[model samples]
Target: MFTTGSVDGTVERKAFFGSMIFETVKQDDGALGITTGVENPVPLVILFLVLTAVLTMIQAIYRGLKQRREQLLEASDS
Candidate 1:
């Protein structure tokens, strides 16, 4: 989840990661401010990539089956 606020013309942002929360506020002097929370996100990234690949394969297989069924029907009609 994310929330944003403004203080004296400066923008403040809050982000949540699991149970950790990080806050970032832009300074009025035009400097960037950031707060760090958890450091490693590699495992989450890898999991998402693997899940995407599996879903793509499943969709491709379903599409191929539908196309094959349609071709068989067309052949029977001829």
Candidate 2:
């Protein structure tokens, strides 16, 4: 993503995909500007998969413990 404001108070914004390689240019008013590059989606996908697996394991453990507690209570009552 890139944003810029002109002397006339008009602001412009843009977004692009792939890597984020940027170049800084010095304008006539001694101001700075940025340029963006490409995008990468592999890391995000892997993170999603790992989080899903962790949540599934936590839910399974919780269910098992709840069932065990119920069985223990039933045995004591009998």
Candidate 3:
């Protein structure tokens, strides 16, 4: 994809070299558009971080419960 910007009867052009690309432009009429692009990474990174934190918290809770169960079993066996 290629991107360029121009205003009020001006012409702009650009070229991109990659599997995918993004193009944004502003027209004289104050309208804008993103021509092409996919898989924006910033939002994905944020989602990944949130999921990781939740999984870590769940694992910690599970470990705590397991330890408590073992302690109770040992006390009962004695």
Candidate 4:
């Protein structure tokens, strides 16, 4: 979640990451305003890639086991 508003003369930018909140006040001595959303997207991208790889391996293993089980069942029936 993200939001922005003007507080006094400073522009307050806020973003919520799960339970963590980041605030950036654009005042003369304060920090610069943050982006409306994610600041560093690299970590999220890496995590997505890792999860995708793991799930793919799991799916492949499950399919192989199921196919083998079906083959054995057919053989036993015949």
TM-score of each: 0.51, 0.55, 0.50, 0.54
Residue 73, model 4: Cα distance from true site in angstroms: 0.2
| lDDT tens digits by residue: candidate 4, 12-76 | 33333322335554556655655445666666677789999999999999999999999999999
lDDT of 1 by residue, 1-78 (tens): 222354543333333334344656566686657665654476567778999999999999999999999999999999
lDDT of each: 0.65, 0.62, 0.63, 0.63
Q: On TM-score, who's better, 1 or 2?
A: 2
Error of 2 at 33 (Å): 5.0
Which regions of candidate 3 fall more than 4 Å away from where they truly are?
1-39
Flag the better candidate by TM-score, 2 or 3. Answer: 2
Q: Residue-wise lDDT of candidate 3 within 38-57, one digit each (tens)? A: 43456656777999999999
Q: Model 3: clashing residue pairs?
A: none
RMSD of each: 5.5, 7.8, 8.0, 6.6
Clashes of 3: 0
- Pairs in steric clash, model 4: none
* Cα lDDT, model 2, residue 23: 48
